[model samples]
Target: MMIGELFDPQAPLAISEHYRPHWSQAGAIVFITFRTADSIPYEVLQRWEREKNEWIARNTGRNADWRKVLPELDPRLRHQFKKTFNRLREDFLDTCNGKCVLRQPDFASIVADSLSHFDGKRYRLGDFIVMPNHVHLLASFPSEETMIGQCDSWLHYTAWKINQQLGNKGKFWQQEPFDHLVRSPEQYQYLCNYIRDNGTKANLRSGDFLYRQHDNHQ
Candidate 1:
């Protein structure tokens, strides 16, 4: 198995926007988080967005594009903002909100299988965990388009399969996922630890989640 590469600041970075910004670097390992559609309540997510926008307006400027301004801020400020946002979301997700069907081993296995199906072909899959309502993983893609396409493929296929098992339809996974390019070896180790400890952090029992670290990930 090929080891993943860290993000190179000097390399050309690809930025794309949907509900949020996505930064991609070819062959760079990325830490990604995607949750079930109902993992977070709509009102709560809206409020968080409103607060974030307000903060941006106050700190940067009114009508400022956060996507553009955020990366230009001082490293400390940027890190603080990212840290706070992630902590808040992580805390909420740990609450095991919504139906949390992924808590079921069979349902969670469907996601595990889907994630690993293209492991070494499309991307180098690393550590990943299936939480009650969300998932976290590390992978490196050959190109930005491949990364985005594979994510879509994983979500779409798993949603179809899981929903089919339940005999229900509608949105399964959240439309937009949170992804970040790994910038250093330290950060990569941090993410691996995060995935490994997530279940315990959530106070979940063994059967409540599925965690996997590829043998060659290290």
Candidate 2:
């Protein structure tokens, strides 16, 4: 979408730094991360996921198309479906977990499921890796809709599943997430490497991605 537009070199900053309004120019691969409040470890998320998967197996006949699974159910359930996702993010976490944020592996299953469910929809997924404490996503904004909107839906759907298992309410992810606009092939390659490596290049323990950054060549 931002193919020919000029990019502002001064827009990217960590949350510890002041917030600024900037997304990478069109056709750029942005590396983004969102951590739980207080930087809790994301590793413990797996401990809570098995229960949720078991519930789905019992209720949904083991496996079913996600888009078709719930809309036909009770109206309240439909409401829950819509309520779980967030635009810039999905959940708010309690800081009691640990120092390192634990990444939920369940989210990978959820991401695959949702992507399949929305296959024909107007969305494009770049590269992504779910770590114990954070996520690295390299996605392209669909020209048909807002990038944040699509991201919100995916996150909410996953969070909804988690919430259903936990039987608790409130936020699951921070409201603000880091986003970047890719401006050059170099930057795109840099982010693609980072996402695939999921910060491993910097000694960060995450799922190694190693995906091709071909989107940059386009």
The C-alpha RMSD of each candidate to the native structure, in angstroms, is: 2.2, 17.4
Candidate 1, overall lDDT? 0.88
Write the residue-wise lDDT of candidate 1 on 45-76 in tens digits: 88888777777788667566566678788888
Worst-scoring 10-residue span by lDDT in model 1: 12-21
What is the TM-score of candidate 2? 0.51
* 151-194 per-residue lDDT for model 2 (tens digits): 56756775677567657566665545676555676676666665
Cα displacement (angstroms), candidate 2, residue 169, comes to 1.5
Superposed Cα deviation of residue 43, candidate 2 (Å): 21
**What lDDT would each prediction earn against the true structure?**
0.88, 0.47
Residue pairs in collision within model 1 = none
